[model samples]
Target: MAKELLINGEVITVNANDEIVEAVAIENGKITAVGTTKEILQLQDEETRVTDLAERTLMPGIIESHIHTTMYGANVLAVSCKDPEIRTLAALLQKLKQHASTIPAGQWVRAWGFNETSIEEGRFPTREELDLVTDQHPVMVIRACGHLSAVNSEGLAIGGITRNTQNPEGGEIGRRADGEPDGRLIETAHMELYQLAAHTRDEMREAHRVASAHFAEKGITSIHDATGYGLQNIEALREDAMSGVIAQRVYAMVGALNKPEEVVRHYMQLDICTGEGDEHFKYGPVKMFLDGSSSGPTVWTTAPYTSDSGNYGIHYLAQEELDALFIPAHEKGWQVTAHAQGDAAIDQLLNTIEKALQLHPREDARHRIEHAGLVREDQLQRMKALGVIPTPNPTFFSEYGDGYVTNYGDRAQRMYPLASYYRNGIPATITADCPVADFNPMRGIHSAMTRKAPSGQVIGEDEQIRLLQAIRGYTLHAANASFSEKETGSIEVGKFADLVILDRSILSAEVDEILGIKTDRTIIGGETVYLRSKEPVNV
Candidate 1:
């Protein structure tokens, strides 16, 4: 492969000092040099391909620390029920019926991105309502959080869920006054029914292709897939990466579901540990959910939700059960990243992790708490001391902030304290739990910097961070969360040439205009994978 040079641009290195250079040289898929245009141009040979940025802004390619690639891809094909698309219960049914018309009868139809709070009804669609859309086809529509879902009568029948069927431990099945299934399935119940509607290998492959292309277009050169759906999902992702269908690097967190022992067996059987695989695909951590989602009012919180006076939310695992899973996984050399949203759940996670550390004593394990949504100051101190990284979804502030206010009231002020994390020297990485929120780093950045909700309300002004800090959370800090900081996080010599060219400087853009900035080009491994159609400015 010939060397490449990107010159005459604002190169925001995002390095230790956050250097701004004019040009960068790449060779053999790695950055070879970064300096002034004249200095970098001197290294170019006759075989070199030079891209004059025309004074465009260049930065390290964005990294999404938390996302479900396969699910995101599948959602691309699912019926759209998100706000602004299906704002009312009537609109939702109409959209579902319209989508069901495109498929044959008796076939399953999956839809996603519906938030009850954003709808006119302010509640999940019931089975009878979904039946109005499709009685012949089994229909399942996922909540925006991906933790809750509603299924039609056909879907219930397919899952063998009856009026007498007991809800799985750590999950709930909604019921009507007549004691019949109401179509609302929470946590485990949601996953159980979803499995019945699983996509085929070919469909999954195509989903991956669509997802990878979408990431490239958005300037995301890397992602940490929060849920690697067991060995099959990992193998599929590897195949996608090897076949060049997935252009970005992927770090997969093993999704063992409720069976942590299964994860241990699989790891031992395959002789695969954390950090296994090449740069393009690698094993990250063993992911487990400690509680449900805040959006569903099921997150295990210390206090009862304002919306539900008596309910303190669901706690998925007992202390002993959590210890049983964590200690064994930690001793087996697997890094753990638990999805703990509420303070109570976070407490359980931190306690289990602390115990695991004491029993195993592995320094720099980099155990992560995904979406520490309601972390306290003391928890932050403990997390910092234990070297635990908190990867929070800042995008939630914009997408679900209004709901947060309704759910937690004044407590919402403490949600996702981005500024507090930095002030206390906690290495926080911001993310968008895509499919929960759109996988747009700019929106996450904007939310972090402004703490502004879609309703034009600021939920927590004290938690707002600077633009630079927000950008770092998406780039360098995100890489650090996955232990890939030394590889591709920043623009530096000897790092992989993962870079993005933006139409404007995110640093200097007007606050309201930040999210409007466009990605001019996305380059990975010294190759241009995505380029805008607009003509580049000539130098």
Candidate 2:
């Protein structure tokens, strides 16, 4: 194969194999040379492809440790209320009433990212308010936290939920002060009806394309997508990969919530793990959520919530139940990540994981603790001792900081502890719990470094990580968490040529201006997937 040289740039080589170099060379789809311009030019020939760097920074492609890609893509193009004007009960109803003319009556009209804290009047949207929008159409507005949703009476009836209905094992049906079904659905296990909303395969595929384009434009080379909807999503991803439309490499963690274990077993039957297929796509861990979001009333907490004292959210997996299912799954050598937000839930998970590790003792197991949000000082040490990775959604700072404040008060301030993870030697990877938060790495990086919430509050100033650390949280640590570090995380010899060329160097940029750094180009395996300007270069 012919050589390709990238010259004249500040290269941040995140690989130990190569020092920071002024130029790099790629032959086929792997790094051939990484050094000074003169050294890279030594490998050049008439057939070589040379790219002028324009003095911008060249680095390993960005990786999102945790993102729900297809879901986020569909949600991006979904018909719902995200704009502030339509966030409230009255405004949402008005907006739905406006759009209802097109849809047939009695169809489910679902919208996502509705925050109760965003409502100026300051209260959860009631069933009555949703009814005003459309009794004919069952309108369900999911909370921004993904822990709750408010649905109209028609939707409640459709789901077979009623005032007399018991709360599901790991979920709840929010009730009014007068003891009525208040139209709010809480926890993953609680919202079975909403899970049924992703029935349209075509819509999901379209959304996946949009979502992928969004990441490519921002220079994301890889993602650890957690929302495993089903075989349909896997098929969609496969189709995109085969066609070369999906440029970003993906490490998928199949979820087993309402999804059958047989489905997970089916994927396991594929006998795939780290670096399963060609450079672009692979399957990694199996994901399970033990609780819900901290900003919503579903995260099982140690004490009663400071806001709502009577309510301590429930746990999804009972001890005996987990022992039966989770233990066996872990013993079978499946890398697992559990969504345990509240400290108590995390403690339960820690205990469960410890037992499994003792029984299994697979050194390279690399199991993960998803969300792993709230932790006591003692728990931090335990996490480090266990060698568990925390895939934190620091994007929560920018997306739901205010909601967290309202939900947990002082406790919320310490949520998403980046510095704590660093201090305890726990390798942490940051992410956007997308569809709930925007799946933008810049947003995640900004939130981690600044700890500045969308409401402009510095929620956890002490917990704020440095810009460099924040970058690694998305890149190196993210790759490690997914067990893809060997092949993809860093820019090194024999590594796949996954690279991002930025218009500005993020490492040297002013702290506040880092988010402004845009991607001029994105390359995967020596192929330019996204190029902003193709005008002839001066060099």
Which candidate leads the pack in TM-score? 1
Top candidate, metric lDDT: 1
Task: List lDDT for all candidates, in order.
Answer: 0.85, 0.75
In model 1, how large is the Cα lDDT of residue 8?
Answer: 90
Q: Tens digits of per-residue lDDT for model 1 on 1-539?
A: 46888899888898888888899988998999999999998997778888888777899999989888888899888787764768888888888898899988987788889888778898888899999997779999899888889999999999999999999988889999999999999888887677667777888899899999898898999989876355667678888987889999998888744443465457645667788889889888877788888777678889889988998888777989778777777887888878899999999999999999998899789999999998777888889888899998878888888888999988888788889989987779888988789787788888898888789999889999997788788899989888888988789999999999998766678888988988888988887789886665333
Looking at candidate 1, the ten consecutive residues that score lowest on lDDT are 256-265
Model 2 sits at a Cα RMSD from the real structure of: 2.8
Q: Each candidate's TM vs. the true structure?
A: 0.96, 0.91
Q: Summarize candidate 2's per-residue lDDT along 230-332 as a digit string, tens digits.
A: 6667667766766666668877777643543445667656656434666667766766677777777568888888778887887777767555556666777
Residue 67 in candidate 2 has what lDDT? 75
Give candidate 1 regions above 4 Å deviation.
Answer: 256-261, 534-539
lDDT of 1 at 62: 93
lDDT of 2: 0.75
lDDT score, residue 5, model 2? 87
